[model samples]
Target: MIISRISRFISNFDNLLALFAGACAVLAVLFVLFLPLPYSEDQLYPKEIDESSPLYPYERGGTPFERADIHVQYPENSPFAGYVTAYLTPFSLALSRLTPHAGTTIVAHPGGILDEILYNTRGLDTVVETTILFIAFAIGSYLFRKGS
Candidate 1:
């Protein structure tokens, strides 16, 4: 809805869509890799389940075994972990079942140094260049519009 205001400020819906798409693509990659969610702190620096920790079920504060559920504060010990473990456990069973049926063939091919660098970097340089180009295109498209 806010972007609708830009229609009057600029011109051409196609340019707006291009700008929106470019911005969204940049944000998607950044959030997936670099941006940390609020639970990231808890996930990274999980407190030990000791007397000093809030997760400790002590007689002084928290009841002992009164809560039969695994708390989300300890993500590693949560039901989600159990679910993921159960899901992946089938893969190992399937692999074991299929191992004897398949022929064993292992091949290792070394890639070039340039290819390795591009693979490891994931073309961040390309992303940066594309982002600059997108910004420039949006600005030019708006400024060079027929009316304004």
Candidate 2:
């Protein structure tokens, strides 16, 4: 029966090792999902710009209304900047709507070092998943080797 086969597999040392490996894979996934990234908003968006920057038109001999009208364009640094903006904008909007009083500004910035960091962090979700898969494979390999 299937139960007998499973029981035999579980009783084997190699199978136990494989099971432990599989458990590690599962744990890694859970950790990544629940893990708080060791980064903060301030750290991610460093004090690169100041009130004195030309981008802040108020500092450049402009009226408050004129400054408000001045729109700083996204610098042409990377091709994917647009895509990242497109994706995060709506997500930020939804977050803002969900928490009306949260007071989170969700503006998209074009490519810079910060942009790259954001992209990498956003993309790291896949890396976390892949790492789990690799761990599982490694454990499985060890178990198979022991069995052999």
C-alpha local distance difference test of each model: 0.41, 0.48
Candidate 1 accuracy as TM-score: 0.20
In terms of TM-score, which candidate is strongest? 2
Residue-level lDDT of model 1, residues 1-148, one tens digit each, is 8788777645866588888888999999988998576654535213233344221221122222222222233455333322221121234334435553221110011221122223333346767878999999999998889575
Model 2 pairs whose backbones collide: none
Q: List where candidate 1 sits over 4 angstroms from the true fold.
A: 1-122, 146-148
Q: Candidate 2: misplaced stretches above 4 Å?
A: 1-77, 82-86, 89-92, 100-137, 140-148
Candidate 2 is scored at a TM of 0.24
TM-score of each: 0.20, 0.24
Per-candidate Cα RMSD to the true structure, in Å, reads 19.5, 15.0
For residue 11, what is the lDDT in candidate 1? 86
- C-alpha-based local distance difference test score of model 1: 0.41
Q: Which model scores highest in lDDT? A: 2
